[model samples]
Target chain A: MPNKNLVGIFDSDEKMLHAAQKAKDLGLSASDAYTPFPIHGIDEILELKPSILPKVCFFGGATGLLTAFTLQYWVHAVYWPMNIGGKSFTAYPAMVPICFELTVLFAGVSTFFAFLFLRGMHPFKTSPFWGLQTENNKFALVFDLESESKAEKVSSLLNQEGALEIREIIE
Target chain B: MTTATASSEILRPPLVEGGKTYGQITDDICAPMEKRPPLGWFVAFTVAGLALLWGVIMVTDLIWTGVGTWGLNKTVSWGFAITDFVFWVGIGHAGTLISAILLLFRQKWRTAINRSAEAMTIFAVMCAGLNPLLHMGRIWRGLYWLFPYYPNTMGPLFVNFRSPLLWDVFAVSTYLTISLLFWYMGLLPDLATAAAHAKGAIRRFIFRTLSLGWSGSARTWRNHEKASLLLAGLATPLVLSVHTVVSMDFACAIVPGWHSTIFPPFFVAGAIFSGFAMVLTLLTLSREFLGFKDYITLKHIDAMAKVTLLTSMIVSMAYLTETLIGWYSANTFERFYFINAATGPYRYCYWTQMLCNVVAPQFFWFKKFRRSPVVAFIISIFINIGMWLERFNIIVIGLHRDFLTSSWTMYHPTYVDWGLLIGLFGLFFTCFLLFSRSLPMIAMSEIKHVLSSEKHGEKQHA
Candidate 1:
């Protein structure tokens, strides 16, 4: 869609934070900002929406509880039921542990998978702009390059915003 | 230094040394894996690997020759193998508590130790998972029947839905899954960092896939923190429930020593105690060898010692209460179970348990002893030994002298049992060694996220 992507790198979090604000104000069409650690309030600065992972956890947990109950009911009450130790045929008291466990199992694992699905984690993949410093010490903000004129404008604006480096990201 | 300290900067020890930057923290924590691993890594890995090999051979032989290789008999049917099962599972508890419970409590000191501790929980549970299977007599179907949906071929009846043993299957598997999810969810950001630092394309690719293309975007962080907190909430109850179910395995039975209302809390405390000891043992050695003293500071060790001290006291009270309740209940069988445990053939186990679990941790009350990592390490090893004996006393001692005098038998572990126990250590250490070298063993982003707060604490301490 563009000639080449432009990436602005910043060494300090403060500079990166302010630079994102500046780039947004300057209307540079920024999409991604990568940092070593999470910067507080940066999501608001990046104009991204809030995540929906909590809903995933909630539904997953409910499903888990129902699954546990259903599995126990199928085994104990409906299919091939038998008496043991003179106890009741359906063991509600005994099912609580499995119920709790499955609730946790379903909620934790499903939420993690949902997270990966949302985040684009899959086998045999590489991060788009993975460099030695990017995920460790440096922060990067990537923008699309529209044209040679726009690329020059992006570069000068990044420089003015106190970016450490501006590079043309071919991939 | 004293002049700076005089100006209202009271000298409270900081959990993280205050001067570290985000980059320095990353480089320092990842250094063991990034650089050529030190000589200590080789020594530990080689030794642990050989030991793990021994364990694997022993387990294979066990499966091939049948469970008869163990010293278990009808009188003490669930001997060392079940004990080892409970032992390893108990040892797995501290990691989740530190990562989930302590995180929920907002203890920042957890950052330095949570990664390795959670790794310990996973590996310890893996070892624990093996014991029940090995204990199952049928070689071809070792505990496969225990699976609720394993397809009962010959029977009109399903597997026992009411059995505590069945509950164990759900509990342990759930514990493992949640621990893994929590651990992996925590690792995503750090894995991205490792991938970025990785030299070869293969290393980069592997870590990148594992990291799920994490770019540490603020939105991603928001999701990650939310997901992690929710998982922590889910895991907190689990850390309590898993062990409670494990305790129910013994308590649900009618045996004199095994049946008690207090068993759940007792086992939970003991599990945390043993788990923390194992964490301390591993982290002490890791910090010394990996040059992480600055990150895994004396404060971290001291805080762990305090936990060790608190749990040990609770455990000792549990021991006393078991005997006290037995005495007050005026039940002869229950009273004799306690008496026999303390004064019978296994008095050695009882005394050593009292010494190591109850007495040894008392040393932590001294600030000097708790602050010294070497001392903490030694005390932790003693706690490990004591906790294993605690399991032995509970499982074997009670089972050996059950109700009928005619059925009484002293259970001694065969060479296979001992080999398997020692071999699991190798298995655990080897996994840890590989982990320490292969992954970012510390939560770099989480630590850096708190750097400002740590700095504020340092300013107060200066």
Candidate 2:
């Protein structure tokens, strides 16, 4: 990661997005972008590969289905297998509704946790980036230019490229 | 003038001729409706409210006096109560299905119908929710179905996971919760927009409470969008599960006419069919009454009608499949029940159902008729009627005649049953009319997102 504190402001979200894309096309490392709102393709523009959410959700759902089956089998077939109404003990068709419900429940809960993990969101921690101003009005693009000179050059380049304003944010 | 100047650079947001943002559209859409005489609304609400109140009283009496007070007997235990349940639940489907499914498919036309449809879903679920409570002879024992708690009931009485009724309990609850969240999530942005435009102490208090300090910030919008997408994803499956579980109520049964592998998909298709039709009916009346022609354009009607037509065909195919399966199964009792349904004492209902659901929607295949509100409204009414008849045929004809010849009996809903059915219309309309007056009936924010002018120079094709 580049140590220099460097940030660029852009006129609009579209420009910030394009800049992010261009950064990735050239295969640069240590970069990030910020905007007033979510620009749809930002993650892809940053060349952040696909998330682990889908796999986690798949496993969660499978676990739910398996758990549902196991519980039902234990209850109906093994635990107190009563021959009520002459129905079969290993009744598969009857287990579908519970299995389906559990699948959705597991998928939903697991996906939520995975999302928090991927975003590195913790309840107690304040965000490292403080462009809450970007939360409302501004579109910002933060770049990790390597040296102090390079950071200044990047800041000046953003201004020259029609950025409304620029400010280096430090932690 | 100074105040105007202070707000000037806030960008008056140049109006896009026919389209308006969530904030701007509300005044344009609701102003005309509200400006119409308050007396008419008062009278309508009063009458509808009274009827709904009466229905509740009757339901209470039934609960107190036992199911004996009503005309429900062993011959047709699933009477108008269940019919209303299915009808209301089916109506509930169109709203969530329209909102979530169309959003997933990226259908822009859903903008006009989604908000009202979701409200309809909520209200319809409320109405459907009444049936099961009333169905149980002792409404007090309703908790036994939700939990394992029942006083004096032996062996840890729990919801039978193997039972279709239990599936319905979970499915409907999940669908209702998901739809509520989806509806509220969509409303948040619009409510914020409304808050910005609002002036009074009441507006500020209510909006602040409802909006939870929303500022349309980038982070909020980002999270809001993701949450909405996730909700829509969840709701799609919930919608399917609800109707499938409802179908299982019959499909799992060994009743001659009810047991069929095709019932789940068939019920779902019919649910969508009747749902879209009901939406068309409401949308047509709402647009006309509210003067929202531009907001809810002829194109929207056309799009919804096309869905109606598509689902109608699916339902019709299901009808055909049931008949084919009856023949293929070679079960004399099944064949007899099917034949009785089509040509017996309930023949009128069967024919009307076939004509209205299968035949009437076919008129929409013509583009001109599809776009006509009058044609769509009439067809929708027919569909509602047909769906009722379909339920009647299924519940009554299938069960009225059992395997034993001596057990055969004719089923008819008494005056009270019919009265409650009509009164429920009053309940449905009362809730709908209130929704129209109080809330943004059309989704203002979603419509703004799809507004063509937003794409003028920077058309980033989705």
Candidate 3:
């Protein structure tokens, strides 16, 4: 059985990245990473797959297109449709421009609202993480703590790689 | 390192900060401010501001009394208000179009004038919005427009989906909101940059709050870029929709001159044409004043000139097409309207528009004239004046000569209209002058991009 509790940290990107590769080479478990700026090879280091955001966007957009089409169709075509200027009651062709517009609008609004929900954004609220250094200068990497012995070794390794500062964040 | 390098390699210069000193750039850019007397500038701005205040007083009085103070008789209901409305709205286009549209297209030349142009858009929209409310005698019912409420409803009334005027309300409001957001979002990174330079607590706090804790991190930059791109994309369609709806106000009408298929494309081209010209005028003056020659280079001037020419040509084509169509439609009313436009009592306005919009833009074909800021400035002024008259001709002339020859009375502007017109200038410049003093008149990041991109090109060419 494998222990999922063990996590490691290193001083700089290059070192932590090097260590992560070495850990993977040694067949160790890695969970996640947190950085001020998204480091390019970080996902590979964590062995995470690409985000499903693009797929989500595609689905959301398609749903929006369908919704726009259906809504316009129902109002203009099906329910209480009036004959004006001897034209078709549905006027499907004229609906294209507005349908296209509404499709974009729905997709955009949905994507935005979903992102806010997923990120846990709320009106009149502070963010979940409130590190002062996060506003400006510093980058932080959080890793799961295992045994007391493993924590000590991790601290030593980070220090060896020129970590300017380090502290245990037990939450 | 070999002694013999490729021509491109040789031509490519390194970006050494020491190449041009800040002092030199400051001296070059800030020369206009230094040359003028601060006292005179202060006095001039004060007078203009006072004039704007007079217009405000008139508006307040109008709100208190009614819209009857103006000479808007039943037939000439739109007169100055609608003309000014279209004028201000048209003026609003250049700023966002230059900032967001140009940004999306990766036009590096937009850097110098974008800040000023965006400011113009906001102020022009502000000025544009006031006219409709003022035109509405019962200003208290202005909120009705927002909620789609009508005369009988306690709550908002159902919006008239068919009326172009109603559509105008939605389209313009959306445009203004999106434009404001776009402008403010772009300003954020720069505001953060400015905030970092702040020394006082108050300034720092305000800047930080406005900047939303931005620090130019790569992540923030990426997100910001994505947000800006999204906004630009949204705004481009919004910009089109706004003026399209405005043109629909005329197209949707049954009047002979007003009812035309060409009005939408015509109005849009004219709006962009006039807007760019106004932008050119202000930016030309701004670069001269602020000493931002390096940022707003000769290349920017030339690019603007070319656009000015293109739009002017489009506008001219629209005019020609309208006239030809009028003749072809063989509607006696339409023929009379176009004939009146050419040889009517307001023929001066028509000819002036022709010379300015149609003829003046031709000079831009000359590279020397295009590059000359002074020439561009002069041409831009003429374009602004020409567009105002175009609106005037469209509204006043087209309607004044009603089908009933008995009712055909020559309509001229009253003192109130003239006062309001001049007052608008005061309003426009007051905001512009303030923008020049406070914000960086150039898009700094965009300028940096231009420099770097050109540096790459230089390397290849060397």
- Find the candidate with the highest DockQ and give its number: 1
- Ranking under DockQ, best-scoring first? 1, 2, 3
For the record, the alpha-carbon RMSD of candidate 1 to the native fold, in angstroms, is: 3.3
Model 3, residue A133: what's the lDDT? Answer: 38
What would you estimate as the lDDT of candidate 1?
0.85
Weakest ten-residue segment in model 3 chain B by summed lDDT: B14-23
Error of 3 at B318 (Å): 1.0
* lDDT of every model, 2 decimals: 0.85, 0.72, 0.66
lDDT tens digits by residue: candidate 2, A1-171 = 425556666655666666656555545432566443345666555555554566777788799789878877776786557676999988888888878877766665666555545454433334345433342234567676566666666665666556777676664
lDDT of 3 by residue, B285-353 (tens): 766655565567777888899999999999999999999999999899999998998898889999998
Cα lDDT tens digits, model 2, B130-232, are: 7877788777777765543434265643445677887787678767766776787777655544544555667645754574444443344455566566667
Question: In what order do the candidates fall by lDDT, top score first?
Answer: 1, 2, 3
What are the DockQ scores of the candidates, in order? 0.57, 0.14, 0.10
* Segments in model 3 whose C-alpha atoms lie over 4 Å from true places: A1-171, B1-44, B149-152, B155-157, B455-462
Candidate 3: give the clashing pairs. Answer: B7-B462, B8-B461, B8-B462, B11-B462, B29-B290, B29-B291, B149-B157
TM-score of each: 0.93, 0.79, 0.76
For model 2 chain B, give the 10-residue run with minimal summed lDDT. B453-462
| CA displacement after TM-score superposition, residue B327 of candidate 3 (Å) | 1.2
- Candidate 1 has a DockQ of 0.57
Write down the worst ten-residue block by lDDT for model 3 chain A: A127-136
Which scores better on DockQ, 1 or 2?
A: 1
